[model samples]
Target: MELYVRLNDSTDKDYAFQLPENATVNSHIKAIFSTSAARIKQRVALSDLMVIRPSIFHEYEPVEYYKSTHPGHLTEGGCLIFDYKADRKEYLEKLDYEKPLIDQLWPGQLIVPQWRMSKKYVAIYVAIMAAWLYTDLPDCISPTPGICITNQLSRMLIPILEKWGVQADLVNKLREEITPNYNSVAAQWAFFGLHVLKVLFTTFFFYIAMANPFSFNPIKMYKIRNVAITQKNEKIQALLKYLGWIGARRATYDDYQTNYYDYIIKKFGGVVQAYRAGAIKRAAAPGVPLGAGEGFQTPLEERFTGNTFKRIDEENPKFILSEEYFCELENNLKELLDEADGNIGRMNAEIRRFRRYGIYEPSEKLKHVVDVRKEIYIKDKEIAEAGKTADKKRD
Candidate 1:
């Protein structure tokens, strides 16, 4: 049986091939790729390709000959259309081409626009809020224990806010509002002012953080740790470990050992003393000792010491593209250019033929042809430019 295959939507021409009567659709698709022109075959893989039967008005249905119970289901003059899946890297390259002028000219590292807040930032915010809520404030304004708490909290929050692109003016305002005052009247006002600022900042951060801008997997940290353990790259492992530690520290630290420890001791004596008193009370009771088997555990011992893998010097790392990848990109660009050129040539011939026969008029069909030709011309230029870029990269 003979089958007509259309690459892309070029229905004007078809590549015809003969196959056995019992051949499946999957086998037919593989044959189409294998037997088609080198340009088409090189750019597409069998796994990345899909076959569809085209119908009138641009509708299509999957030709599932592989699942068919009956043999010889494919009829004569039957047509199958092929299309390539969008390449993510190619999309990013195109994005680089179409970036805004301001973004292109911006100094320092370019941060791609994120429409939502990152989960990491949200986690950090929640941790900060938790620390604030659990820690107690002093009753008297003269001693200014509340002032110390506010200052310590502000110091911690400012860095996080700046990291997430909070406006400088707002950060400055936060610092100003939270700054401690010596006078009693002013100190009281400052206390209330700090509360208002915290509420405002928390609400604002929450709003922005609600939108997840990056493709961050929730389990990425665990994945990284697993990779670090298994992979031989020491530098990468170290980097991953460092990042994991930073995240852990941010989430776990509650100023207990540093800023808040003194306050806690002043209020409730030493933590050890409190723990001992609780233990004594629990000993007297028959119930499952209050909060038993809960609290901090000792740090786990490390297995590896020095770096095992070479650290990648990212400052001037060389990038080497695989020959197959380079060839695929080149062929894909050439195929696109050829398609556009063929389309333009065919449209030009049609227009000339109509004009020679005196059939050309200001009809919608002619106008459509002219518009299509213009579009083809633009596409041809873009494809040619892309092909040149690909060639340069290959070299």
Candidate 2:
């Protein structure tokens, strides 16, 4: 088979090869470097060689890894490129990149909610609320509908009681007696049930897909593929785009420093490639690689997460803390203080009234006033801390 190779170092140059029909990509790579050493010189390391078949679409072709194990993947008269790599050994032992990094899952099944604040969930909640409101059918303001429902039920039962030769007046009196006793109780339960239903709806709205809940591979095979703790990839976004949320879903963490090696291998092509070019380090400390260097570890977190923790706030410190945020905090603090003062005033007046009647053993209302004061104190301290933090930012 005749093949043309373009060197990474010399992109303008082309090298031709007449290799055996049974030749694999790994064998061809070695043959290129071995035979072309005279012409190519010591341009790249023996440990650093990769053969890539360029895609016409300007995207990476999955055919590179395939060419090694599947001979037909690189056919006769193929145009290929040679690039510097961190590993040759792994190239000979290729991974199957063709098996997708993720699988498609529908929302037919559900798992616990992991992500939140989506408008989709909000809309679903609204619809559920509407249905609940219609079915539960309030008769009064935030009503139990208990008395009204029981009255309508009793009206039908009263006629039956008349047929059974029960006194109508006695029956009406009995109905009136029980309804008064249980009316408030029924209202409280209705309110309680509303709260319970709200929690259930929230839980349901937040549920994730049942299988591969976090965008994991459906077939968990470790036989051929290497173990990896990969970061969230773009495959989910791509899947969502193609499937339009209806077709695909994501059920989308960390281990020791050594745990990231295979992920790096999977990502950048190999271990040496990762250490030299990717985020992995043979470190003396966490991020500090041993050139006898000092400082924290090279950030594995930042490498995958792109420095998400420490966000860049490019606002003026004084304007944000001393003016804007301070105002908001002050308003909240003032509101709590005012509420506490009002409660104290009302409780003191009631105490005065009780004392006038000579019934002054200190009631639950007085105790409640003290609790409100304590709550106010806590809120004040919390608000003060926000102010203090704002001051630190300004300073």
- Clashing pairs for predicted structure model 1, backbone only: 116-211, 117-211, 234-309
Clashes of 1: 3
Tell me model 1's lDDT, rounded to 2 decimals.
0.33
Cα lDDT tens digits for candidate 1, 103-123: 221110011111223456557
Model 2: residue 32 alpha-carbon error in angstroms: 36
Candidate 2 per-residue lDDT, tens place, 267-381, comes to: 6787677677834642211111111000111222233343211221222100101122223333433443455566887655433322111111223332232233334445667
For candidate 1, what is the TM-score?
0.19
* Runs off by more than 4 Å, candidate 1: 1-183, 210-395
* TM-score, one value per model: 0.19, 0.19
